[model samples]
Target: MPEAALPEPVRKRGRYRRRLRSRIIVSFVLLGFCLTALFAFATNWARQRVENQLVEDVMNRNLDASWQSYARSGGADVMAPVQQMRAFLIRPDMPDRLNSLRRDFPEWERLQDGIHNISGEDADGKPFSYKVGVRKTPDAWFFIAYDMSQALRGEQQLKRALFFSVIVFSLLSLVLGWWSASRVMRPVSDLAARLRAYRGGNAHPEPLAPRFPDDEVGQLAEALDDYSSRLTEVVQRDREFNADVSHELRTPLAVIRGATELLLARPGLDEKVLQRLQRIQRAEQQCTDLIGSLLLLSRNERGQGSSNVARVAEQLLESHRAQLGGKPLELELEGERDLVVDAPEAALSVALGNLIGNAVKYSQEGRVLVRVGAGMVEVIDTGPGLSEKDAASLFQRGYRGTHAGYSQGGGIGLSIVSRLCTLYGWQVSIRPGDERGVIATLTFTPG
Candidate 1:
């Protein structure tokens, strides 16, 4: 699609699934980073606030209890079950002064420090400064210690949730990608099917069903229709020209043949008359050959109806072999015998006949080898090898090599052979015979 044609918003909406997924991931990560940072900082600040409040509450409770005990019962067991009660506010350590008091006259001096904090942060093991609690009691000391291990663990769990979200989003991206790609290709695939039908000689491209009437692919389909129409026009014109030429030549060839035959039938012609008749006969023969060749060429160019290719191959081979007139040849038929091709019987026969005939004409005493395979017939001639130039242009229309001087009709046979081969979607090759002779081979392919 043209970039300018797509609006900025539409262009930004990428159809590429992988790129879309990557973009989603990047956005997710950015959001996650900002949220995680804000949340983590907020959580730490809230936790610190709660910890300070808890420490203040603990100090006030202990001081009140100690003062009541000393005033009412003269320093009774105020911090009853000291080990359990002290663990609530103090770490598993005691200063030298507090230890000495606990062994002798203990009246809650540890709570007298007035609630204070130790050096450390609540998470990631960072050090934090201390804070003192309300200093109402001179002998009591208060301390605060915050462990952020729990907060860190909570953040890790949040990270795990984020990762899980990413995975879910990625899967959704995959499904979206597949659906988008398939939708885009649907029109193109339909256009291709129509083009294939047109190529197979079915309906014209213009009449083919349009998959998407207003899309770029629809425009391509229209172009194909235009091109196909022009091609059909050119082909019809060429066929008409061929038919006209073929029809026009027939009448003159008939007159020439009739005149030549009448001259030959004259009774007891003198030497001069006989020579003239012979010349006339030669002229008639050339005219007949030319007319016949031209007619076949025209029919081939105009395209003949397809027939049973296997039957054509078999029948043409049998008839031509018999016509070879006792020429030494060996036939090798391999692959499937049910091989079928789309071509006229007559054109294929003429092409194969010419190839075989040339091989026999050049074979001398060596056996002519004919091999039949799937859509292919090869004729090998153990005769003079072909030159590089002859191999290249031997199949060209009316092209004849030096060897044509020795072959009949000055090598028109090979040129005709090539035309018929082309019409039938077959290929012909002439190369060194692998010994001291030439090899002429024909290979056919599915049209």
Candidate 2:
């Protein structure tokens, strides 16, 4: 079965979805986010380490000073005081408040040395944070508490700043990334636009190297210029060669056509001789039509002329019928009259001629019908039906069908037809007929 064609806009959308701009933007966003997040995490960790060290140092110094004052005062109950700190001696007869803390938090009493963080409520039932240093003498233990509420608030403020900075930097990175991508792609976009605007014919395009800086884009421009120059030379050589070959071939075909017409005009010719002359005439005509079609293809341009498709089909059928050597096959044309198409008569004749000729060549004793309708010409042949694989690749160059056993062809007939249809903005499709044989359809676009 033939595949359905997608709409042009949908096809373009699929192609655009994978464009480089989106990929570049996504890469930039991920990079910026990862870097900023790492920075924020490291900032928080460093701040925590420094703040804890300073708080522990302050608690240790104040605890040592209070202990020194108690010793100098000869173990006085009331010792020298310190700012934002309080010292306590834990004994069996300690106050209920201090006893309650040691009972509730066993870890605090278990501390042999060093500083610790403690969380609790004050007498007014207000939440508070503090750090403590525990010192154990021979007969007594000293616990010093330093308030940490201010330091905690400061840490919270720093954390808030770092969080906002991450958000702000990420957004800034996104903006900068978008701007950078636009700048990076500008030259490439310009190059593409210029390429799209180019209309190729006999003239070569302007050099693009001089228009760009000596960057990667500039190197690309230079490469494109060099390639275009070489390709132009190749196309020019091909055109000259085709023109020379077509000219040289025409002289011999003209001579053969003239000689055959002269011999056919003679009266009372033998039946065998007449048939041979007619066949020679048909062969010359086919050659001439083929040459014309090939030259048009080489030029890659549509010929400016209108021809009746039915008339062309009828002529092709008649020509094929002349070459059938006593074959029992019947050729018929069943279509609307005067179905004109906007193309040279020779091109149409060559295209339709190849189809009708193939049908006649393959069938031994069956009928071949050419039907012309609204915008289509279908050649229905009663030959063996084509396989799915053969139908898929039938139009490819040098690809013969599975049933093309010992056929005298190079497999270029359908290839030529397909090329001609493309040049003339037409479509050709081959599919198996309802039960047997193949139906080849040439659908022409209305101008």
Candidate 3:
């Protein structure tokens, strides 16, 4: 079925049943990952900045010390200031040593008073990185190189450790989220389970608030208990009212039935009086059937019996025939007679009676055909065809058709029929006839 064609409550339920705990877990995981990622980025940035400043400072100091030592010794002492450092000096007067230094370190001849970073393969084809500080003087140029291979390795290990820490914390967050969600949802889940357990019977269920702590869940449970109590009271009162009304109305109807029967049995009575008495008896019977059906509807229960569709339709047609008075409306029953319904005669009577009554009431000079089939009965009327709005909402309570102007009815008969059909698992629908009037079908075998 199309989703738009589904009932409102069903559509709402389909849209809103997502799991809350799963949402909580996903939220925690994302939060953990983002926080850890930001922390790792900040830590790596700070470490890089501090390490570069410290290494540059040490290189500059060592280069200055080497320059001073070489100048004081008149370009004699060529040793580097730090153990992990190498120094080289080149003089403008010594062409042999200058040529050798230029050949050995071709890229470092453009010496200025600053620290520079260099990284490349060495003579042995091994990768090397260093910070080089240069000092230019009138006597010579000094170059001091500080090896950075060990620091580079340590930074790589730290980066690996940070990456693993992020992963570990993210996993820990996931586990913590799962545990927290479970703890938070436990009472709500229990409340739902207990509510589900109280599904069908038990008008007065156990109090849910007492079983939970004084928290949000407990408050919800308390509200539910209050609502349930009020709802139960309302339902109980409605059932009592229906029972009382049925009992009270049946007494007068029974009296009328007895009086009508007595009058009907009298011999040689006036034809008009006899017909009136018979009509009165049928009216009483109809009132009784309507009351029984309404009572069943109010209680939302189905009465059990075997009802012959043809017989009930025929009786309804006959009753409507008498009520038609001088109107030129012809009532007829057609089709199969073997169709039986697993519903009480009163329910069937009320359902079919409303259809036939509506047909008789609406048609002025045409026929009303009640056709019985395998698992369905159709009441076809040759009255003015119903409008689109009428056909759509004909069975809604208090809804009168457009053609029902000045009609002596409150528009509840068809609604009762609809409720009866629902209680008995039947389907009822009304539509415009092929040429004129309306066709109302009641199907006992609903899909």
TM-score of each: 0.45, 0.85, 0.79
Backbone clash pairs in model 1 (N, Cα, C under 3 Å; residues 3+ apart or in different chains), count: 18
- Residues 297-365 of candidate 2 have per-residue lDDT tens digits of 999978889999999899888888877789999999997987889998889988888888888987887
Top candidate (lDDT): 3
Say what the RMSD of model 3 is.
4.4
Model 3 ranges with Cα > 4 A deviation = 1-8, 11-18, 73-80, 83-152, 268-275, 325-332, 355-369, 380-415, 430-439
Ranking by TM-score: 2, 3, 1
- Count clashing residue pairs per candidate: 18, 0, 0
lDDT of 1: 0.57
TM-score of model 1 relative to the true fold? 0.45
The 0-to-1 C-alpha lDDT of every candidate, in the order given, reads 0.57, 0.83, 0.85
Candidate 1 lDDT, 1-447, residue by residue in tens: 111100123454336524644554555555555665566566666766786687567656655665565457643334422222342222234476456647643433444446544344536766434343333334433322234345456656866665665655556555665666567666766776666655434334455425458668778877776777787777668768867876787677778778878877889889877866666665554444445545666555434556554465455455445445566655343345575556555566666667766666666566666666666766666766677777666665576765656555566777776666655556766667667566665666743
Which of candidates 2 and 3 is the stronger one according to lDDT?
Answer: 3
Q: Please write out the lDDT profile of model 3 over residues 182-285, one tens digit for every residue.
A: 89888988998898889747767788899999999999999999999999999999999999999999898989998888888889999899888988988888
Write down the worst ten-residue block by lDDT for model 1.
Answer: 1-10
Candidate 2 vs candidate 3: the TM-score winner is 2
